[model samples]
Target: MGAVRVVLVGGHESADGADLAPVVQQLPEAAVSTPGRSLLSQVRAALAGSDAPVVVLPMTWGRDPVMIAETARTLRWVAGGDAHGRVALSEPFGTTDHLIALLRTAATRTATRWPGSGLVVSAPRASPFDDAELHRVAHLVRVHGAGLEIGVACVGEPADLTLAVDRVRALRPGHVAVVPAGFATACPEADALADVDFVGPLMTTSAVLRVVRERTAGALHDLGHGHDGIAAGLDADHGHGYAHSHGPDGDHTHTHGDHAHAHAPHAPHPDPHATSHASALG
Candidate 1:
């Protein structure tokens, strides 16, 4: 049996983001395949080429149910062959504890940059689970980010942002800094509002990279070896190309959080931004 190999798979949209390169660079042993092609295509390539068991860590915020489900189907299709059953998909990177820390750092910088400004954390509003994750981030900010007013907004709809802006402005803030809950810098959805500053996305921070490394390590130990049965246990009838339902009895997933982090620059950078979203209003 060959040694286990870890690979980080990101959405195809972040193909050219220079910040993401550090993850692969930092972990010389791990291979990272970014989105441009399909997620299934990247997973297949990694598994087929590696000699050892493969653990794929999807570098996304929140465990995107669609992407997670697709990964299972992709592995079952590619790894079912005579490759010694050595392919596994780890849960998404959003589970990391460092991310909330990073969010605090980002929000703090935003507040400090503008001085006495309230914070509006923004997300794309993809699914109900996504919304829950955004709410979780909001809770984190409210607890750790004392002296700062926090507002959550789903950027997908106009009314949500409008309401969030009104509420945030009501705090008599110096300004409003919009931080991406996942990995976003400039959210046009919020940009339309006046006196709003955009904070850089969280995809490229050292803290985030460390979290990826930790998750890959955990998945390799927890779900990598002899876990094909768990992956294959998904229900066939689940919709949206899902290989399994999200039920606890058969769901093979893991989540991570509760750690510390260091601060980084909050200046917005232009690149292929992160596609993972925690969206819709609440």
Candidate 2:
């Protein structure tokens, strides 16, 4: 059997291949790609003249419509239509549940070390669904796992850092413990906040790599069992032609043209959270 090719897809401003070198080195046939022309070229190369199986893993913590939709389009472009059965688009590397778990772990550590410090979960601004998901994750962590008062803030939401810190300060714990979710580094202005103790990004941890491996293995298994996986759903979701222009801050805008199918980015069933990919394309 031919070796299964693996493509690790990251967001536009995501850390370059250097940060993903460990993952690539471990996988025998793996390469890293970002959206737009970079991913288009990579997909073309990966699918050229071979029927060998390929697996795509989105290296994100939660729902990323831009990356997922673009991957679908690129695959369709390369295949001259829908991607074949041999190709699979796995779920993102992590999810909101994963973020909740990570934050819960960090909350425990922070509570033990700081004792009375309140916890603030900071995340980068993303799509509405993702932002809502982060809020939900924070709620879960606060209600079930965290002993300390926990608040949530987004890096570039309607409020600024000062206001966010002030909100956390209102909680009136001994100190404010800030933890970054969905990303590795705290906001650049996090240091400016008074009496804030930053906890972690958790990007370089073994747990992250483990999640990547698990997603890849699951995709490969689905391919082996005749499941086309999320790629088919993505292809179906974007039956119309569209182009993307990325902003300096990694924000993206879509120029959709000549729509032929329903625009349902999240309508793809058997979501990554599901146990089996067999019915996702149906």
Per-residue alpha-carbon lDDT of candidate 2 for residues 56-113, written as tens digits (9 for 90 to 100): 7777655455567677666555543545676778866765566666788889999898
Model 1 Cα lDDT, one tens digit per residue, 1-282: 126666666542133233357556676666666432454566556566667667776656543444544455555666666754566666566642445666778777875777788887776666665566567768877788746788888666777877887798898556887776665534676677788777767655566666766666666676545665325323211232223343444423322122223223442222222334333101
Worst 10 residues of 2 by lDDT: 273-282
Backbone clashes in model 1, listed as residue pairs: 11-35, 12-35, 12-36, 125-279, 125-280
User: In the order shown, what is each candidate's alpha-carbon RMSD?
Assistant: 12.3, 8.7
- Looking at model 1, residue 30 earns an lDDT score of 68
What local lDDT score does residue 190 receive in model 1, on the 0 to 100 scale? Answer: 62
Compared with the true structure, all predictions reach lDDT values of 0.58, 0.64
| lDDT score, candidate 2 | 0.64
Give, for candidate 1, the lowest lDDT window spanning 10 residues: 233-242
